[model samples]
Target chain A: MIGEFSPGLILILGALLVPLLRGRLRAIYMLALPVAAFAHLTTLPHGDLGIIELSGVSLTTLRVDKLSLLFSYVFLVAALICVIYSLHLRDTVQHVAALIYAGSAMGAIFAGDLVTLFIYWEAIAIASVFLIWASRTEDSYRSGMRYLIIQVGSGVLLLAGVLIHYRQTGSLAFGALGLDTPGGLLIFLAFGIKSAFPVLHAWLPDAYPRGTPTGTVFLSAFTTKVAIYALARSFAGTDILIPIGTVMAAFPIFYAVIENDLRRVLAYSLNNQLGFMVVGIGLGTDLALNGAVAHAFADILFKGLLFMSMGAVLFRVGTIKGSELGGLYKSMPWTTGFCIVGAASISAFPLFSGFVTKSMIMTAAMEEGYFWIWIVLLFASAGVFHHAGIKIPYFAFFAHDSGKRCQEAPLNMLVAMAVAAALCIGIGSFPDFFYTLLPFETGYRPYTLDHVVAQVQLLFLSALAFTLLMRTGIYPPELRSVNIDAEWFYRRAGRSLADGARMAAENGWKSVTHGIGRTISVVIAYVQRHHGPEGLLARPWPAGTMALWTTLMLGACLILFYL
Target chain B: MSAHRDPKEKRYWLDDPANVTRLVRVFYVVCAALIAIDVFVPKHGPFAIEHWFGFYGFFGFLACVALVLIAKQLRKVLMRPEDYYDR
Candidate 1:
């Protein structure tokens, strides 16, 4: 029997048995994997449990701490919810992929050394791509390939950083790695890429919407949150991250405002939410860090809820494009209601999950004297509510009637969504219980009258602005269009650059080959001109002429030798 | 409630344009009332900016309007036909 193992190993190894079962048995088994892991995680003491020396270097496979434990619990919760959402899927590949993906994310969070984190990091990237490929569309295939390359590239950066850092520091410990050296900077970049740091963020919006509906819900939860956990562990209080987080918070809302794919809109919203957490980490106070981790927990559930609701709509209506979808509330009332809850939560309405967690970050920033940063964050908060909070449900479910009719989302889908929605409310209403799970101790209260009144005023007025903009026709309509983002550098400009390079190589080779052929032909012609039958050497000369020529050549040779 | 609607009435409550107008009117009152609470309720924050009456409300309103308007103009440069990547 096993004494102890990383809880993540359960899901990773259990995925192998998923194919052997069918239907309800498979669902039950899949659900049980996380449930068992969560129970095991709760029982495990906070210490390094699996340490073995490999080549004189001790590799730690399991390191349980408050931070890792918090992240692991959320990962398991997400895995269960996502599995429930996908219960109707007959596709075995998605089930296995999602299980392994979630497991790898959990593994990354608990890793005590860079090597362990790197292995699970790569595994997470490779396993999650199957979710995108499970869509089985040409677009999904190509998108998955790109996503795989960039994600694996991030792993490569992490591995390189780990090697360099080990050579310099003589250890592979995953601890506070400030950016004072090349290795540390490389590791930070790896985390930045995963966290969707501005320019590095293109892959997320590109690939996430391409995943199968249930697959996207799984996609939304794990990968980025792991990056946040890593960053919080290693790079907390780094000054550059504040600016980086600012841009990440600011720019995405603009893009989300015009993005047509509703799921893609959420992807942008996810980036904006990550920015909030990153800033919290940057502040690095107890309240800030606690706020960051807590906000991540809230984001996972509410963001998952939002994604699940849209997935339900996509499952029934067969379209998630905002241009083609509207007025779906009549046909799918429960989904619409759940979606509103998610919207309200994301908007940080009073007595919601977002309000409790986000307030900590904002308050922490102010306490830390990030005056301008706090101001910008306030603006970002309003913008987040405007785009994600208002635009998503407003455009998809209630803007105008696309006149599309369908059944409500399947029972399993509704159950999954309802569970997620309930959790969003539960965490919002009773955050005291949730606060116990935070890595840091705090006596912060979220229900202050001033804070509540301020938040409510901000949200309500944002809604009013939306209403006024719609009434005056200043608001852009949902349309069948695309917006160029940082991804434009790769998707269009990068493609053309590759094409141009190929064309240049082709022309260069053709010219070189043409010159070589021309020279060869010239040599051949010159040879034929003298040696062919019609040439002087080939002409039938008399024997006397040959003899005379030979005599002349002999005399010249004799003269030259004498000289 | 929707299931028990009259057969003669084809439109739901949300479908009526008048209800939406009244809702907007009520929304306006709600916004006004929310700001009015600032007078009676004590305000506290790290900075003096938080003490300004209806600061968040106005900031939220202006910020959202600016985002929309700026984003609308952004479309001029960033917007492409639906199949921009495919082509």
Candidate 2:
């Protein structure tokens, strides 16, 4: 069944042929592939597919486990919506790349071993860059290049780690290789880079917002989620990840709060959301792991929805920046409504998808007595509501109505948002379907009275905080400026270094040429003074005179040596 | 290029009575109601409906209103120079 004519691969592979057709037929063909893929995805049996051994080495692969299954299912759903959202786009490169990108991510989820996962992992990196480049602008082009470098660099690290890990343990499985050695740390770094852990996160805000509308949606779903999956598999229950994850959760909120580019803010929030999953993985309990996996599933759905709506706005009016957007609700109510659902879900409002999954991690934290970590995570949760949950929808849909009207996004965009919106609500309302796919046996229920009550209390107070801040004019409003992030290092420091090197090289060459010119001039001057017709030595030093002088000098040297 | 425009269009949300008053009233009613219910209501299921209404529904409504009003306010700030992302 794993290798059978599954639609996930088929739709992505079939999309490769979309460009060969012309006009409306091309659009229809591109659209048909994902629908077919979604159908294939939904039909797959919800249990492990057998692992394959390569070269007599067991890869320890499993397929259709609850965690992997949840992500795979959400990937298909998000992909279908993205396809519709991007139906009007004519870029064949982006179309093919997006399908391949989404399909390969699903491929990674279904992969049975570290090797298969690694293959798809690199495939995602290689295929996804074209979407960034599809924007076809100089900045986008440059950002895409940087994006490619970081992503491919991450793959190289993974491959190296995999080789070392294979040599160390003689197994190529994808689970619980704790940070016991250099190779393990290397593997963690590999996942860390993709997961956008702190300083490694430059590529996200740099690249995602730079992609074409449809392209950003595809960017939002696969890359970080794949890293989350890898981390869950490899480092779950590792205590070190708890603090790393906590920092990951908290730091991005400040950036998101201050960020002017609404899409980029979402990108930061993506890092924040990944932090929640990492914390869960760090907790490493069955319930906690379930939360991480479950959160990955919900994150993809709602985050994709947020990106889709923003993409729609960009598709129509051509801007998603808060400074450039507002009053869209008047013109595009359905899109606005869908975006709110997405926002609420991400904010962890009661009866939202986040409400169901996020509590798992927090409960795990408290149970494990990581009291400080729990408090920090709770703070991060409030920050999430402020930046992503409230800020994204508020600015794009209804914030001071920009009054500039464009046509609403096409039918496909609406359908995409609606589908994602439906999943966000469905998962929140009925988490059993989602929980049943978790890898660990879960005795915990997300909808218990205590869980619901506390989550409500948390989110409600957070909302209250937002209102107070807004009233006091203290909340950071989106502006029309670039906020500095780690990319500042490359953009400012890297550029200055290049400039400095060029200047030094220029000066060094100039000094060398000047010195050589002076030496040649000095030699010419000496020769002119000594060998000119008027000079005695130049005029009279014939063979006879030169020989006499040499004999006199030799006699004088002998006398001086004797003395 | 007409310099003479309605003063209301130039006013910020905090400066505008109509906007700020409406927002402040809504914020007070919602926040007070939710906090009151959260403090008073027994924390349990079924009655969890009250908690949801107090917290989720009330704030959710506030978010919607804030979004709408902020949308109104953002109208002044929105600029549409072609291909803003390109630069």
Candidate 3:
């Protein structure tokens, strides 16, 4: 009986009850839902449930497998953290949106068929946009619209791919669809867009920063991670993902470094981390696949931790701009500490979650004879440590004082951050507990002597370089500026194209009206000349003209008769 | 000046310029020591280039420096006022 129930349905249906409750009841209800779903997930055995046949097509609503279970476990954990973080808020809409978004992500992961996956895919898009809109800023509104369009566009492509695939293969199962077919290609692009692949990545950094403090935390955990799961499920072992992922991993660090907004920098860093998972999926070995999933699991915890810390700063100080924030560790020591933990975890320092997970992919690359790709990944690793580890903490906490005093984050926010930070450390210190949950069994050890020494040298020397650059003033100062990325083509070039079209339309209308006016005037002149009282037809000799016209007609008739 | 005096009296240890300078010096010494230890430790790098003394340290340092320099130039092309999009 317990196996028949869907964990995602618990959260989705549980969301409907949110508006009915008030005060502490609503808070308790919200917190219990994620826990309930998590418990439900633990009890269910790995098998399919809720299978339905519709018009000769089968839809699998609940499919319990190791991969789905792995993603669902992390999704629920993230939801619990987000719910606790947002407990102080009275925004019923955000609460509902967060639940539905989390539920839909779970639903997507558990979906057995492409049809079921498509439903949850679109559900995630519709539900998550509300978080951005919760900010109620005009900028957030616009950014939310842009996020919606891109997300929904991804959904449409997924639907298209699914339908084409169903027609072509006569089955709707969600599994490996290599690049040999159009449907598979469409599905890959859809996942690519959501995964924040280079050109299609702008919406993430653009919209994530615009969400409310707590809302951004929820937003960070689900969407792109879900896409990573989808990619791992369908496109594992695709060779193209290597270069695609390499580009994804490498390019964002440059943007992250020069970016002023701390939250936006985290967003870029998120994309960079996703690139590692994508590369792992490309490598397609048992170790690499496990690395991909394990990294995804760890990423949700640590990235959410990073976002939570920045959200706290934004909550207290009303800005996360690196230029405007400094020496905040004075006032918000706990939040600062948590932020550093997050930074260290993300930078893959020794004994951190990232070190254990990210290295597997690197090792896989090297073992598979991908010498150059491994080199790029290594360079990216150093670069990530540089921006996320050093830049975030240095600018926000340790640089010259900005003289802005603010209280530490609210109690609920701090508690939530502590929970996430604990998990980050817990996973880093005892990765075996996490490794057991991965999709495959492995004997990979992250703490080999060489890995430890090399990692330390990479990180410590990067820190040294940062110190030297800062002292020499060679490092670029954080300015109150936006560093343009791929979004520029759409936000700028696309807008310009729209403006040109509008101008052309306006000019075309003017010319059209002018031509119509000239033609109308010509017709009016002809009418006036012919129909006016003093015109030739109205002259006093009209009778004589009629007689001549009749005579000419009769002569023509006579000539016709003679012929 | 009176307002400044009270805040200055409440300054944390980390807020002191002397403390910060000392910490930075200590960090530099630690970095130098780590690099120096590379010479004494047994080389176990998988790649031949990695066996070079201080290779990781130099690579990390040069990578960071290059990233900063390249990013600085990128800023010249990509940086705009924060309200660039809003306008």
Candidate 4:
């Protein structure tokens, strides 16, 4: 059975068998499966794997290329790290869900045909919600439901788009489709939601932090990356993504700066990172594509690492609020350092993973003659230093001692953090390792004196700004409470509107009933005057009177119809 | 634990169990080990992973240290009343 299946399927199937084993064996299975899958994916030659004929449509179900390869590589790596992080977890459901979610995304990335991609795409949305629900909280449950609804809606739209695309072109090949068409626009919106493009982003901050610690790690890797994969595939070279991505890069930093929950702040940062990838795809050159693919790969790792550290804090201390945490370095110093590396990497500090990959996207923007966009990106980069780079670690770890000494995270969690931290510095120090995997020819060196010095200058300036703001008490303080986001449309405003409509309808019905009562009473009085009975109908029981009433009713109906 | 203390008596911030050095030492050891790993691992080739692994591993460790320290710092900023955000 394993021999007949592709290596990707084999890996997923092996993961499926993990829960059947107990204790240490499960951990081994979890760790080894992803490594094996990574080996297989890296080995595949770039070309069409095979074609499957479905309903007279020849669908390219598996295609291996530079673009898909980059994302699949990250997906596999994240699975391995999450497995290590959750090694202590014996929860079969969460374990199985994480694997299925990871594997399904891999399946989508390798899919050569639109139909096949759509199948795995929907699987991603469905399999992923379990991660959120695993938190076992009422708030998580409600948020999970909302997340599922939006994801499913995206899937439905994709399906509709696929059907229409097939009808219009009669081909199911997975490649770029124009946005000018109806079906094309539908697919774009579907990808947009998964990518967390602007207004469609509520599902991210709303549900991501609500997931189980381990579950959130997996969540960080798959959904947006897959959306990025889709956008890279379908909308590469789309002119609209340029401006859209520029706005995306700048808009979320404002929110991240204000967010109370550290994890939610990371979520906004995730959106900002995706903006980088969008710009790469928009540039649509070989260099740009490489930048996009490379950035996506780097992003999943660092972002997952960041989320994992936060998850550990949440797991141990029962809170991720910046306000509720501090002075824990005295008790959980490893976690504090791990958070610093993550912060530095995210801020694009020198010799970190982010320094190597993120620059490619910005350079691509500058090289592509989008200097104005590059300036915006520079501002966004500075903003990243402010929020993700400086704000997360400084406020959470070093800002003020909260005196909440939680134990160091468990051994498994430590190992996971260790593994992720190693990757961040390793990639930063040796850009060549990551550069070789780029889809474009990588003549661009990230560690040149000019680039490093410029980045350093940018970061220090932002740090200076952060310090000045904090000293002045103008920086938004992280406190325990829900902060509003785009979700307020559905969570608060939408509910309020619905309630108002319901009340109005209810009151309107009451008035109509009251009016009917008044009419009935008037008729009763007329009947009493005529026959001394309770109503006219009760008094007028004679056959001739009844016939006269029927004729009169028929005459009135005929007159109304003619009028 | 503090119920026996008279209301007139002044309290010290160091009195909390969270501020004790014993637990802090444990945190320090853990942080040191992670920093060691982050600083030295890639120079040793057997530990090297692909792009994503390297990226995640590096930041992830720093995040861990930051988490520990953030826990300490949070006490100063954290509000006692649950309705802190209400204002």
Candidate 5:
């Protein structure tokens, strides 16, 4: 049945023809791929498709449960919006790679078997690095190399886990595999790496900001969310995620506050947002799972919107560094307005998407008696508002005039941002309409008066703190500097280690060459001493001496032979 | 050029110093209103600290202040030249 066919394949196959067509046709064709795929998603039947035997083992190719379907809906929507955002590009490699990346991510989410998931998992890694490399700069090329290694490393872990898991259980099903086994733990770590769990996260802020303007939009939507879906499927309700989620939510915000690149700030914010979802998965209640999924849904849009706005800024102004930009509201008023909408959505303002969804997870943590975790989440909530909610738009568009004036973002980019911004407001305003799509039926209402009051107070107070800090010159000023994170070990310390090794190797090589030269010269001198004109053998009596020595040696050998 | 303004130069209401002050003043009023409402409203949570009057507001404020201050100290160690990696 067509229902069993993977919708992700639509873009994967369709991307092949993108380079063949001319400009307008190519745009229309690329845009049609996702729309067609989304249309196909609605036609899919819920439940596992027929298992096909692959050399004595059965593999589930398509599983269309609410969970997978929910991820697909957002993935396709994001793909459509990202394709629209990148329509201004002439880079065919980027165009093709973005679609394939998005498609493979979608494929990974819908994968029903561990082997199938691994295939799509590695595909996502290989395909997505091009988005970063699409920037075609030396920095981007290097960043993409590191990104590829981490992403492919995640896949390698997944493959090893899958092999071990299949050997142990004799099942390739991609369902909940608890961390009781080493294979399950390996799989969790794989997902954790992609999820940007603390130390595993450097790739996100390192590579994302370097992606080409439109490519970042595509980059932001797919890869980590695929990992989130995998975790939601296999590792939901794991207690460790509670603590991991807190670190994910909290530590990144500190980086966000000090980050100079606006997009990298958004990347840190992305990590913080993922932390919230991770916590939701940890809670494992119906409400919490719904919150996790809903928040993922909302995040794809709001985060994508944020990336798009910054991308437009980078596209026009040639920089996303907060220290180098301000008063851009004058030239790009529409972008500034859209960016504020995105900011409000991420900040979880009362009428924005973050409020309706993220609060569900917080309420779950509260209900489940995760008091310390809840406190950390609350602090993360306020801090996210401080950096992402306020600092992004404030610095990029309002803080101080950098005296840059240019045309507003391309119409295509504005349209894409506007669409994402609308969804953010739309989801926030009519959350019930959006919640109907949740995988589980949770009888939770987001707009209770008490919930509203608590959230408003928290957000407003955080804003007040920001105002006071700005007024008192207490907030750290955005500067032209880099703040080292865990990745610094590799970028700095690791390179230093490598450089030390290289220098040692060079010295070692130099000494060996000197020793070899000395030995060769010594051998030559020894030989020359015997054979040169000044040597005894080279003297005029050398012939008589040679005859006597030969006769003596011959007589000695003859006497020994006789004996 | 006219004494009042140059037509070529663009400006907005936010450019005026008075308007920024007004925005801040209004923001303070809204925050104060939020606190006042928190006093009258019933707040519930899993923990006792959550129910404390003005707890969310005060906690958020203090937490943000601490986050910024600690981050400033961290900057001493973490901050490097923009070209630090490139170098």
Candidate 6:
């Protein structure tokens, strides 16, 4: 029975107990829940578990396959890391929300049927918004509301698609439903919104930086990766994703470069990295699929590590703005070291985790004859190194000293970063460990002579360019400003439209009232003249007037008859 | 006066002007060394363009330059005060 139990439920139930526990016990309990789930995940065989029939439709709540198992492992690991990072906080609400968020993501991964998947999908959306709300700022509250609306909107689309899909085919099984059907396209767009596909991407950059420090670490790990998993599960090899993914990869780099909030820039970089995985899913070859999955795995660790380091900085310094931070390496050397590891991993430096995983996607692109996409990917790669690798560290730790000093990151935060950092290096050095966990087997090697040389050249030259630009003062300086993004159309134009509608309604109401007043006045004057004690009918000779009126009416009737 | 300076100020190595100069020089030297490696190794590229000396180097450098320039121009159109949304 324990073996058949859904690992996700274990964490979800554990979330309820968070309020009952005390300080050290609470930390231990939180950490132990993910470990238990991961252990349960490893013991299960590759078959459907937790089957229940609802209204004659079979709902499989747990599906133990390689893909599901791999994602669950990483999800649990990220949860553990986040729990450790947030151990200093006394906020029970955030702790509970983080657990539910991670658990629901894991549930969605193991969901064997569409209905079960939809349930978990909505759960993830609802649970994760609290992370944004935990910041307790008006901005965070507003952004969290926006995040909730968009996420729930995706869920509604998914529900509609599921209903339509079930009608088209009498099965609620979740599998590869291509874009040929209307339902399938709807499902694809739903996943696209969650995956941060270009126009649907604004929520990520908008809301991610608004989360509390520890909340962001959890936020960065789950939502988009779940979408990537869903896309890999359903829409693999869709040619449209190729171009869509290429734009996703390429456009974010420009925004990342100019973004002043260090965490927001990482969020943009996260979008860029997700692009590579999306492209791989489009390729849909064994190598490409493996690349996408492998990159997803690597991304969670590195991106989580990056977000953790920045979170620690935010916790200590009270701000993550690039313009407001510099020379923090003086006060926070361990964080600096870990941040560099994360930056290098994200930038795909050779002997780092990104190099081993990201190369698979590039190799997949070249092999599939997507030469132009490959070139754009290459440009994105270089651009990522410029902004994320060089700029995050350069501005935060090494640039002109902002003359602000703070205490080093707390011990719990340091321990979390160290663990994630070790994993990044471990996976990079031993790619075989991660490759074995991938859903597909591949003979691809990441450390081939040409691959290593090419990657090194690209990264080093990008670094060279950063150096030159900084010296020449050609690079844009970080300022205390916000860059308008796709969200602008809604935040600005949408408000204006609403305002215009409100003004029109007010004017229309005013005009209607004025017209009614004039009509009432005219009617009252006519009444006063005809029936009130004013004119004609109210005169003393009413009887004579009535007789004359009757005679005139009779004469007019006779005239009409004659005519 | 020196004693009145923040204790953390003395711990930062880059606070010294000499150390800053040395770090800059080291960065330039490393760049030069990386570029020099192009002369020694033969590139096994799939395209003819890759056969050009320092192709990746030039591309990386130019890409960064272009990204910054384009982003600078984009900022002219897109940048707003930090409280743009608040207002």
TM-score of every candidate relative to the true structure: 0.92, 0.81, 0.92, 0.79, 0.92, 0.91
The segments of candidate 6 whose C-alpha lies over 4 angstroms from its true place after superposition are A1-3, A510-563, B1-11, B39-45
CA-based DockQ, model 1: 0.55
Residue-level lDDT tens digits of model 1 in A16-119: 89999997788889989999999888788878878867989998888998899888888899999999999999999999999999999999998999999999
How do the candidates rank by lDDT, highest first? 1, 5, 6, 3, 2, 4
Model 1: reference contacts kept, as a fraction: 0.87
- Residue A234 of model 6: what lDDT? 95
* Model 1, CA-based lDDT: 0.92
How does each model score on lDDT? 0.92, 0.78, 0.90, 0.77, 0.91, 0.90
Report the lDDT tens digits of candidate 2 across residue range A185-204: 88899999999988998899
lDDT for each residue of candidate 6 in A11-86, tens digit (9 for 90 to 100): 9999999999998999899989999888887788889888887878898888888888888888888999999999
Worst 10 residues of 6 chain A by lDDT: A448-457
RMSD of 2: 7.8
Displacement of residue A107 (Cα, Å) in model 5 is 0.5
Task: Summarize candidate 4's per-residue lDDT along A266-307 as a digit string, tens digits.
Answer: 998999999988988988877787778787887887888889
lDDT for model 3, please: 0.90
Per residue, candidate 5 scores C-alpha lDDT tens digits across A52-91 of: 7789988887898989988998998899889889899999
Report how far off residue A137 is in candidate 6 (Å).
1.0
Candidate 5: where is the Cα deviation over 4 Å?
A: A1-3, A513-563, B1-7
Between prediction 2 and prediction 3, the one with superior TM-score is 3
- Is 2 or 3 the stronger prediction by lDDT? 3
Model 4 gets an lDDT of 0.77
Local accuracy of candidate 3 as per-residue lDDT tens digits, A1-563 = 43566689889999989999999999999999999998887778788887888987778888898899999999999999999999989898999999999999999999988988999999999999999999998999999999999999999999999888878988788888878889899999999999999999999999999999999999999999999999999999999999999989999999999999999999999999999999999999999999998999989999999999999999899999999998888889999999899988988888888989998998888779887898788888889999999898879987977878889999999999899999989888898888888888888888877677888988999988888899899899999899888889989999999999999999999999999999999998898898778777656776787899999999999999999
Candidate 2 lDDT score at position A171: 74
Best by DockQ: 3
Off by over 4 Å in 4: A1-6, A504-563, B1-87
